[model samples]
Target: MISKDTVKEIKILALHIRMETMKAIGNLGFGHIGGALSITDTIAALYGGAMKYDPKNPQWEQRDWLVCSKGHAGPAIYSALALKGFFPVEELLTLNKPGTNLPSHCDRNLTKGIDMTTGSLGQGASLAVGVALGHKLDGRDNFTYLILGDGEIQEGQVWEAVLFAAQKKLDHLITFVDYNKKQLDGYTKDINDVGDIKSKFEAFGWHGQEIDGSNVIEIIEAIENAKQHKDKPSVIVLHTIKGKGWAFAEQELFNHHMNISRDQMEEALTVLSAELEGLVKE
Candidate 1:
């Protein structure tokens, strides 16, 4: 279990990743701002407080695996990876550039720390489950973390993955669903109501928990609790605001899947700076 100090570290790492995300995409001039921002806290909990990884050996056999089910949010993952020293922080500026390895979607083969190439939504969740099963079969003490968007759940495959994980009793897998209520088009309710993802997972024989995705402490505890329930895979439904820290961006649906404008970039940095200060106090 993580102590107060570890929880503090998670918050600090979250703030740093959130800031790095804004700066990285700010350099790219645009990217999936809303979704990336929404999952920053979970990313922090995983990278800083949960996952075991090495900067020098990203492909280490015992390293915990992370699959970005909402692959467009690769910016957040990249930021965390860079901060964890998987790569030089300067490379973040080259994100989405024609020649850069970092594309709009995460490609595991291309990026050092990414475990799966995931852009097609629901498939990544299934892939993460597969990795967990592989670990279990090999008798390796590794965990698999999969981060999915609420919109991504619209895909039929995601439910299939959820059912499969539960049926197989893949306890090593912990899935986080970004239940921000917004998707690419608009609110998730407007797009295609994903009716009670928690209940759905529970019905499918999985252990489901609801959490405030933006809360670092809640994220850490929920995941840790899920880890202990070995009868089934755990699914955490995280209630979050799409553009978590940016007020203007949060209100605009179009901002859910947009690049940063020059003015927006400045505003993002300002908000991030304030958030960083707040995190330091924790």
Candidate 2:
């Protein structure tokens, strides 16, 4: 079990991830806001607590791996990596710019800490399975974590990877489904409703559970449980609110990808700054 102080620290880290992600995308005036905000807490939990990685040695042989299937949420993971010293935090402002290492989608070749280049939705799942199986074959104990968007799961390849992971009994592989309910077009239900993601993973033979994605403590506990279950791969379905944290983005219906004016960006920064102040006081 994680200590209370550690939980508080992780929560602060999550807040930092949200603030940095907002700042990075706000610099561009627009990007994948909804999915990036939705996955901040989960990414924080992984990078701040669960995952064993070295920022100084990103290619450490024993370090764990992360494959972001919902690669559009790259900004959030980038924020975490930056805060953890994977690279200079100032580079976040250069997202998607000419000659910038930070592309709109994650590129392992370009980024220092990224394990795999991912942007094609369902493909990351398959790649994650391959990485996990390879680690197992090499007699390594490190876990390969995969984060998938709820909308991305509509692709058939995700199911194939799920089945293959279970068949191989890749117990060291842990997956998180960011079920934020909103995709780029609109709501997931309005686009393609994936009914009961937990049940689907369970039926596919994974040890699955559903949790509140924004709750840091729940995320830590769920990951701990997943680590304990050694007979099968584990999947956590995170029920989250898309465009979380920032008031304007959270309430906006079409916030999946948005053009943020100077005023809007200032408002978001103000709100997040106040949130950080409150957390630090606590």
Candidate 3:
């Protein structure tokens, strides 16, 4: 079990990721907010505690790697990276602007901390598996983590990578499925219901677990459990709420991507600031 103080710190970090992500997206007036918000807590869990990385030396040979297969959630990762000192926090305001390092999708070439350039769905899954395998071949103990969207599993190539990871027994590879239920157009049930994500991964020879993605404690515990199993890769199905931290966006039908006016941004910022203050007071 994680200590109370560590849990509190993780919660604070998650809130910071959410606040910074909102600021970054709000700067552009619009972005893929729903998916980005859903994955903030998980990113916080990894960057804030579980993962081994160096902000000043992002390419350090001994550090672990992260590949966000759901690349549209790049804003959340950027927020965490900046907060961790991979770049200046002020740089987050330049997301997607001309010549900015942060883009709509994660690009290792452009960003300091991003491990792999991943925009096309299913491709990052493959890249993550290869990286994990490469690390194993080199006798390195570092782990490679990947985050995938619920809708992204519709791609056949993702399964191919899944099969390969199992065959190679990449025990150091960990994956998370942000099962937020909604995709860009509509709910996953209406579009393509990837039935029982955890069960499907288990069938594909992965050690699978499902947990509340928004809860930092559950996210941390799941990673701890995944570390105990050594025969196969692990996948944590993160049941999350799309647009989790924003009330208006959570209720909007088309929250996947939309324009946010200055007033809306101000309202969100005010609410988030209050929440952060509450956490700090605690």
Candidate 4:
């Protein structure tokens, strides 16, 4: 178990992830705000407190892997990677820029710390399972972590991957479902409802748990518990709020995807700056 000091460290890192992400979106003026905000705590727990990675050599053979299945949240992942020293944070402004390596979707070959090129929705989760399996087969001790959007669970491929992970007993793999309950079109209930993902993964042979995705301490605990299982993949279905932090966006319907208007950008900046005032780095 992690000590209280370590838990504090995790919270600090999560706040920084949100800070940098808000700044990046503020720069872009508009992007995948909801998904980006929802995944901040998960990114923090992995990059800051859990995963083993080197800022200078992201492809180090012994490094633990991270796959952002909900790739639209690449902005948030980029924020954490930069803060973790994977690359210079200033390069974030070039996000989605023409000819820039940082596209809206993550590309492992292009981004120093990114382990997979993902934006195809349900694929990254499955890919993480594959990575874990490969490591296990090779007799390596590394772990694979992945995050998925609740809406993406509607895809058929995700279930196939779930079954595969369970049957293969890929215990080295862990996945988190960002249960923000809203997608691009509208609330998930109005769209194709994804019945309880926790129950689904559990039924398919996973050790499943649910937690508040925004809480760093709970997420860290979930990861710790997940690592203890020896014969089943573990999953934490994270309940979250779409467009969290920025109240205006948080209250908006379909904050799933949004464009930042000039006025809205100013408002978001004001709110984020206010939120950042007391955050300290560990």
TM of each candidate vs. truth: 0.96, 0.98, 0.99, 0.95
Compose the digit string of candidate 3's lDDT tens values, residues 1-282. 799888888888888888888888887899999999999999999998899999989999999999999999999999999999999999999999999999999999999999999889999999999999999999999999999999999999999999999999999999999999988888899988887999999999999999999999999999999988898999999999999998998987677887878788889989988998998888
Please give the TM-score that candidate 4 achieves against the real structure.
0.95
Tens digits of per-residue lDDT for model 2, 26-60: 88999998889989999999998799999999999
What digit string (tens of lDDT, one per residue) describes model 4 on residues 1-282?
678777777667666777677667777777888899888878888887689999988889999998888889999899888998888989887888788777888998888889999999889977888899999999998999988899998988899999999999999899999999899999898889887889999999999999998888889889999999899999999999888777888899978777777677667667666655655432
Mark the regions of model 2 whose C-alpha exceeds 4 Å error after superposition.
none
Question: lDDT per model, in order?
Answer: 0.88, 0.92, 0.93, 0.85
Alpha-carbon deviation at 255 in model 4, angstroms: 1.1
Deviation (Å) of 281 in candidate 2 = 1.1
Q: By lDDT, highest first, what's the ranking?
A: 3, 2, 1, 4
Compare the candidates by lDDT and give the number of the best one.
3
For residues 1-282, could you state the per-residue lDDT of candidate 1 as single tens digits? 568888888888887887888888877776888999899889988888678998899999988999998999899999999999999998998888888988889998899998899999899988998999999999997999999999899999998998889888999998999988888788889879997999999999989999888888888889889889887899999999888877777888776667678788888789778877876865
Query: Which portions of model 1 show Cα errors greater than 4 Å?
Result: none
Candidate 4: the clashing residue pairs are: none
Mark the 10 consecutive residues where model 4 has the least summed lDDT: 273-282
Residue pairs with backbone atoms closer than 3 Å in model 1 (clashes): 30-259, 31-259
Report RMSD (Å) for each prediction in the order shown.
Answer: 1.4, 0.8, 0.8, 1.8
